[model samples]
Every structure is written in structure tokens, then in C-alpha cells.
Target: MKARIFVTLKGGVLDPQGRAIHHALEGLGFGGVNDVRAGKLIELDLADGTSDEDIDAMCRKLLANTVIENYRIEKAA
Candidate 1:
């Protein structure tokens, strides 16, 4: 089975890297972008029958920093 995790900063958290990217985009003449948020995508290959609970645990334990970030799990085909 393949699992994909999306980790992103929580609201109210400062994101300097995202801000820099947004500025660079505006400098390149890419307008209409009001705000930008950056995140990470992690793809995992797991043995069959891995339960959702296990995946969730992975996110909570190490994949994401719960205090400052949130994560979503998706099962990939």
C-alpha cells in the first residue's frame, strides 16, 4: 500500500520561506496571489493491511509537528 502525507503550517504561524517565495513570485510579475502557504508531501510504501490508526500514529509521532503543523493522510492507488 502507498500512503501520502501532507504537512502544513498551522494558521497564525510565521512562514518566512513561504513569504520569500511569494515575494519572488510577485517580482517575476505573477500577480493575483494574495497569500502563499508552504507544505510538505511525504509518500510512503507500506505493507498490506496497514491500518489507518497506524498511519495516523505515524503522523502524530514524527511526520508532523502537531504544535505548529497539521497533517492529512491519503491512501494512494
Candidate 2:
């Protein structure tokens, strides 16, 4: 089984890295980009029958910082 975790900063949080990317895009003559936000994608290979609760625990405990970030989990065969 495969699990994909998407982690991103919540709204109203400052994103220096994202800002930098946006600025660079502008410098490169790209236009019409109103905003940019950066995020993380983590892929996990797990044993079959891994419970969703266990996956949620992994996200809460170590995969994501719940205070400033939000995470979404997607399972794949």
C-alpha cells in the first residue's frame, strides 16, 4: 500500500519560500500570477491492512506540525 501526505501552511501564515518563488517568476517575465504557496508531498510505503487511524496518528505525531500546517492523506494501491 502507498500513502501520500500533503502538508501545507494554513491561511494567514507567512511563506517566505513561496514569496521568493513568486518574485523569481516575476523576474523571469512571467505575469498574471496573483499568488503562490508552497507545500510538501510525502509518500509512504506501508504494509497491507494499515489502519487509517494509524496513518492519522503518524501525521499528527511526526509528519506534520498541526499548529501551523494542515495535512491530507491519500491512500493508493
Candidate 3:
């Protein structure tokens, strides 16, 4: 099975990199961009029959920082 994990900062957290990207976009004449948030995508290839509970555990254990970030998992067809 193939899976994808999306990890992003929770609300109210400072994102310096996102700010830099927003500034760069404005400098390049892209207007109307109110804000920017950056995140990471992780793709996984697992053995067939991998359970959702196991995948969730993976996210909790190491794929995401539970303190600052949240993660969502998607299974690929």
C-alpha cells in the first residue's frame, strides 16, 4: 500500500520561512497573497494490509511533532 502524510504547523505558531516566502511573492509582483504557511509531504510504501491504526501510530511516533505540528494520512489507490 502507498500512503502520504501531510504535516503542517498548528495555528498560532510562528512561521518564519512562510513569512519569507510571502515577502518574496510580493516582491515578485504577486499581490493579494494574505499569508503563507509551509508544510511537508511524506510518501510511504507499505506492505499490503497495513492498518490505519498502524499508520496513525507512525505519525504519532515519528512522522510528526505532536506538540507543534498536525498530520493527515491518505491512502493511495
| lDDT for each residue of candidate 3 in 1-77, tens digit (9 for 90 to 100) | 89999999999999999999999999999999999999999999999999999999999999999999999999996
Q: What is the RMSD, in Å, between candidate 3 and the native fold over all Cα?
A: 0.5
lDDT score for residue 26 of model 1: 100
Best by lDDT: 2
TM-scores of all predicted structures: 0.97, 0.97, 0.97
Write the candidate numbers in order of decreasing lDDT.
2, 3, 1
Candidate 3 overall lDDT versus native: 0.97
> Residue 36 CA error for candidate 1 (Å)?
0.6
Give the TM-score (vs. native) of candidate 3. 0.97
Which regions in candidate 1 have their CA more than 4 angstroms from the true location?
none
lDDT of 1 by residue, 1-77 (tens): 99999999999999998999999999999999999999999999999999999999999999999999999999986
Q: Model 2: per-residue lDDT, tens digit, 1-77?
A: 99999999999999999999999999999999999999999999999999999999999999999999999999999
lDDT of model 1 at residue 15?
Answer: 96
Q: Using alpha carbons, what is the TM-score of model 1? A: 0.97
